[model samples]
Target: MVRGKTQMRRIENATSRQVTFSKRRNGLLKKAFELSVLCDAQVALIVFSPRGKLYKFASSSMQETIQRYRNHRKDVHNTLREQHLQQLKQEAIELMKKIELLEASKRKLLGEDLGSCTCEELQQIQQQLEQSLKRIRERKIQVFKEQIDQLKEKEKSLAAENEMLCEIREKIGQQARQESNEDREMVALTESSENSDVETELFIGPPEGRIKRTLTSLYI
Candidate 1:
């Protein structure tokens, strides 16, 4: 008959549990000793019973083994810490490089840091600046044209005003000349009337000469 597999668990009975603890402790110590002797390996084992009894085994001095374990752990910890610090330092270096690149890019955008630029970069910047200058010049020319148009309009208005003023002056001069000619013609007519009165007086004899002739006739 084939036997069934035993299920491993804690023994409920106190005496049986103590017996099992004793047997397992001795067996575990024996296995540890054998493993150390056969393989020339260092071993340490420790156990605590339910009654607070200590059971321990070590291939070497227990204190020495514990110290060695602690030292090994310390070394592992130091190694991991050093690796972490090195990774952090590498990350910091990369971050610094990124920051420097950003700063350089910012300076370039602001029209600074040109001395270190490559030929292609310089050419690109020059092209952009030239395009901006062309746009600015075009705008300036447009503004100048608008201003010139305004000035031309103003000049046309001023020319019209000057022509109107010239016409007004010509009309005023013509009126003045007409008035002067009328005054001259009136003076000439007055002078001709005065001369005709003088001629009529001379054509008729003097009243004194007629009186003297009548007195002489009465005397005769």
Candidate 2:
């Protein structure tokens, strides 16, 4: 039967755990020494037991190795920082060049800096200007048309208002004329009533009575 793989876990027996710790610690220190001698490499190791016993190894001065590691990390960090700074400076240079190009193009569009332009470039500029002017003219015409349409709508509204006002005025005139006619009819009726209230004496006695009355009226 094939042997099963040993399960790697902590040893619960205190004696067995201590024995394992001693053997592993010594083996690790021996391997570190061999690696340092064979490869001419710096090596440092430190281990602590459960009872706070220290186990340590170093192929060179431990302090010097630790200091050299820290210095190497710092130098690497500075190199990366310098590279990032150079990248930023290069980007800034590229952006400045782009801005200059844009400014030059703007100047050309505005008809400035034409001394370096060839005939073909001049013709291209002229075409661009003409296209721009055409668009401007079209926009202007559209605006004018919109204004005219608005004015027309306003005029229609005013006309409708005027028509409504005229209708109101006509009704008012009709009312005034009807009132005047009614007043005239009332006046005529009053005058006819006053005329009917006058009395004339009969003619038989009227002639003599009328003559006496008339003479009496004249004397009074």
Candidate 3:
């Protein structure tokens, strides 16, 4: 039984070592499975023989569970590191804010905010203001480029739409022209019919003199 004291050293005999490894491996696997089944726990077990053969088991994927374990352990170790880094970032931001506030206070004391700053503070403010201005200029350049791109795309779309509109307008104009010509032809034919009827009436019954007068009237 394991209750008996044994020397705290590696087993020297190859056979005994092998036997011990086998027994312990079986016990470890049984315990792993029992924990998974009874407690609904995710479990993974791995062992390598002296000959370097892989032995692995898991409640789910052996590889995935081992990887998860390693990642979880790493995250745990880095928690304090993440906190420290976050604190440093906060401190930096606070320090910058304080520097800005201090500069502003000094400016106000010198009546700069009210339009009278010492030459030294003015120089410092100018340098910082120049840096800020440069950053804004860079941002504006990027925005301007984006706006130009958008304008180019918009112009292309408008060009295409305008082309379509021009084609539609031309078609409408052509149709109107066709309709006008048809109306003119109809008017000409109607006038010709009236003149022919008048001539036939004159030839059938009217006197020659009256016919000439009618012709003159018709011409008028």
User: Which candidate ranks first by TM-score, i.e. highest?
Assistant: 2
Q: What's the lDDT of the predicted structure labeled candidate 3?
A: 0.89
- TM-score ranking of the models: 2, 1, 3
Cα displacement (Å) at residue 219, model 3? 99
Per-residue lDDT of model 2, residues 17-86, tens digit only: 9999999999999999999999999999889998999988999999998899899999999999999999
Better of 2 and 3 by lDDT: 2
Prediction 2 TM-score vs. true: 0.53
> Where's the lowest-lDDT run of ten residues in candidate 2?
197-206
Tell me the spans in candidate 1 whose CA falls farther than 4 Å from its real position. Answer: 1-20, 118-220
The regions of model 2 sitting more than 4 angstroms off are: 1-98, 199-208, 211-220
Query: How do all models score by TM-score?
Result: 0.49, 0.53, 0.38
Better model by lDDT: candidate 1 vs candidate 2: 2
Q: Compared to the true structure, candidate 3 yields what TM-score?
A: 0.38
Where does candidate 3 stray beyond 4 Å?
A: 1-3, 70-74, 87-220
- Cα lDDT for residue 72, candidate 1: 100
Residue clash pairs of candidate 3? none
